[model samples]
Target: MYGAITAVKDLALTVRQGEFLTILGPSGSGKTTALMLLAGFISPSEGDILIGGRSVAAVPSYRRDQGIVFQSYALFPHLTVRRNLEFPLEMRGIKASERANRVDRILKRVHLKDFGGRMPSQLSGGQQQRVALARALIADPPVLLLDEPLGALDRNLREQMQGEIKSLHKEFGITTVCVTHDQEEALTLSDRIVVMRGGVIEQVDTPEALYDRPATLFAANFLGEANLLEETGSDVQAERSRPFGMVAIIRPERLRISTRGAPRSPDADQRQSVIGMVTDTVYAGAQRKYHVQAGTRMLTVREHVASGQQVYSPGDQVRLEWLRSDVRFVTP
Candidate 1:
């Protein structure tokens, strides 16, 4: 408790073998602290950390044999890419020939084969990121800890690197843990995600399950865009009009927007309908984001850009419908 300020509290988790696990949270959410604790950089106040059925709470960072990729890349300024990759091997006192082979293999694997001789300054941001990842994996550690490894890259580069990281995990089968505030990144790459807030684990589950059925209000809002609606003391189980009592989570993408007097009845009987007025509309290349005011609550809806699709304008009466099973319940 840093002088009575608890940075992390009541955090519990178990990572399976060769799984791509991501700890997703906002700033000061204790995500980084959890990674540090697993890496053996810091010991937890009252909990024991078990790795492969052995406790590693007392082990030092260097002795843990875990690979870590920092947000800043943490490569030596004066060292070339080759030497930087070689640092971990040199620290382990491996044979000179073995270190050379391992460095060459990883450099080639990360697609930085020819950039080894170049200084870190001579490389682009993406190249430097690849080098950092190679350095971390060159040692063949059992566990890999990535702390916002793609935060320094642009949007395009970040997306590209996400694919590469996932590919590497499949090839190496290394049990990986990544900490990031980016929701999309976590959703795209994680086999399972652990959501944190105020130093507590809010929820942990597969991305599909977590997004489709979030058990808590924090998770329902944090993972993506959500329309949280309050229930007015009615049993939602019996009435199709009433949402899941307490609070209902209607995802923007799950909502279907239809202009008044639409020709087609798409799944009419199975869907719950809400009458609202279009408040705003945002056009994008592949789809449109719409804001609808239904009963004093603003709800967002996303629809694909389809040929002959009806576009609703402000002040237009519209109906937003979704399958009865789509409205997930989020308890207070």
Candidate 2:
């Protein structure tokens, strides 16, 4: 409890074989603590951590057959690229010749074959990150632990590394558990995501399931941009269809925008529509976003950029429409 500061409580989860699992949460959410507990770096105050059906509560971090990559790419600055990769194998008492072969193969695999003679300080940020990943995978551990692996890279580099990491995971097929606060990164790389809040697991599910059908307000908001809406006053019961109050989640992308006074589509009768004024317009390269004021609530609507798509400007009146099924309910 850190002398009265409890980082994690009542948290439990399992990682399946040959799967990419991501632990997602904001700062101070115990995500890193959970990873440390699993890695045996920090022993659980009370409870057991099992691997292959055997509790490893007494196992030390060095004994655990897990590969770890940190945000800082913890490499020995004094060691060359090849030496850094060989450090793990050397610890396991592998012969020099065998270690050299393994390091050579891994360097080639990570496209750093020629840079083996260079030091970690001689490489770029992305290259250094690659070396760190290669070092982690060179040992061929059964489990790979990544703690904000891309938090150190720029936007373009982060995207590039995301693809590289995904490809490598496919090739290695090691059960992976990554920790990240970036929701998009989790959605991008994870087969399943574990959402945590205030030292507790909020939800665990596939990315699509978590985004499409969030069961809680925190889950709804954390995973993506959601318009939490609810009917109040007269017609609340009829429109909301819930005896108890709950918020309806509407994704910005799920909404459709049309100019005011336009004839509703044939399916409009079965869908929900609201009229609003275009308060603001945001132009992204591949898409456009509109902020519309409907009653007291401001709704966000997104439209993909297309050659013939109508672009709504600020101050223009518009109508937002979406299928009734798109409005999913979540507990407040």
Candidate 3:
């Protein structure tokens, strides 16, 4: 067990070598604890952790042979970029010639080849972050662990660095485990995402599966915005009564809105359409979000608010309809 809190249940996840697995959860969800435990910073109280098929629960931090990066960058302010990249090599007693060559190569790879002489304060936030990543990769550890590495940068820089990190992972082919709270970041970078809640595993699958078929109510709500609706009492069955709870989860994008009196198709099922009055419309780039009030329920619909499209305002009566396939049954 890596930094996972023992009093709270910890999930045992097996990450294959050279795969990019992301531990994703909200704050205090044990994602960071799991990363810490895997990095050998903290010991598991009960169970053991295995790396490369060997039990590594007794391994000390310095002997774990894993490189770690944190949100704060943790770059040494007093050291020049070259020195910062060289520090880990120096600690390992790598030859000066090899150290210089590796630093030069990584500096170029991270696009900081010309800034080797600059101090941390002299570089931009993004540049300083790249230096930190370069330093982490300089040692070439077998496994790489990251705890919200791009959380500090602005939106644009964060997106740019996410690409850089993905590219770097491909170039190195090292097994990586990242901890992040950002859904899009996890979706974009991870080969598989392990979603956690209350220090236990909620679901572990590719980003697409976790998003489209969340196993639990918490997993459904945590991954993205979801509209949860209770099924009518008549729809309940004996076998699914306790586990399924007659609830359905629908993503915002799965709904479509039609004005009152619009003709319904012959195949349109009444169960999939809800009568609602437009309560709000938010103009988001690429798509607009419409909040519709259907009786006591509020349904959100995402539609492209393109030129020549019919725009509905507040108080307009509309029907929010979706396909039955879009409705995912969540575990109660």
Q: Judged by TM-score, which candidate is best?
A: 2
lDDT of candidates 1 onward, in order: 0.87, 0.89, 0.84
Model 1 C-alpha lDDT per residue in residues 1-332, reported as the tens digit of each score: 55687878987799999999999999989999899899987788887999999999999988999999988998898999999999999999999999999998998899989888999999988899899899989889999999999999999999999999999999999999999999999999999999999999999999999998898878988999888544312222313454444577778998788776765465677776677888898999898999888876788998889898778889999887777677676766
Question: Candidate 1: global Cα-lDDT?
Answer: 0.87
Name the top lDDT candidate: 2
List clashing residue pairs in candidate 2. none
RMSD of 2: 2.0
Error of 1 at 143 (Å): 0.8
Give all TM-scores, in the order shown: 0.94, 0.95, 0.92
| Candidates, ranked, TM-score | 2, 1, 3
Off by over 4 Å in 1: 231-245, 264-266
**Could you tell which candidate, 1 or 3, scores higher by lDDT?**
1
After TM-score superposition, the amount by which residue 101's alpha carbon in candidate 1 deviates from its true location, in angstroms, is 1.0
Candidate 2: worst-modelled 10 consecutive residues by lDDT: 231-240
lDDT of 2 by residue, 161-214 (tens): 999999999999999999999998999999999999999999999999999988
Cα lDDT tens digits for candidate 3, 122-238:
999899889988888889898999989999999999999999999999999989999999998999999999998778888999999999988888888888888865532123222
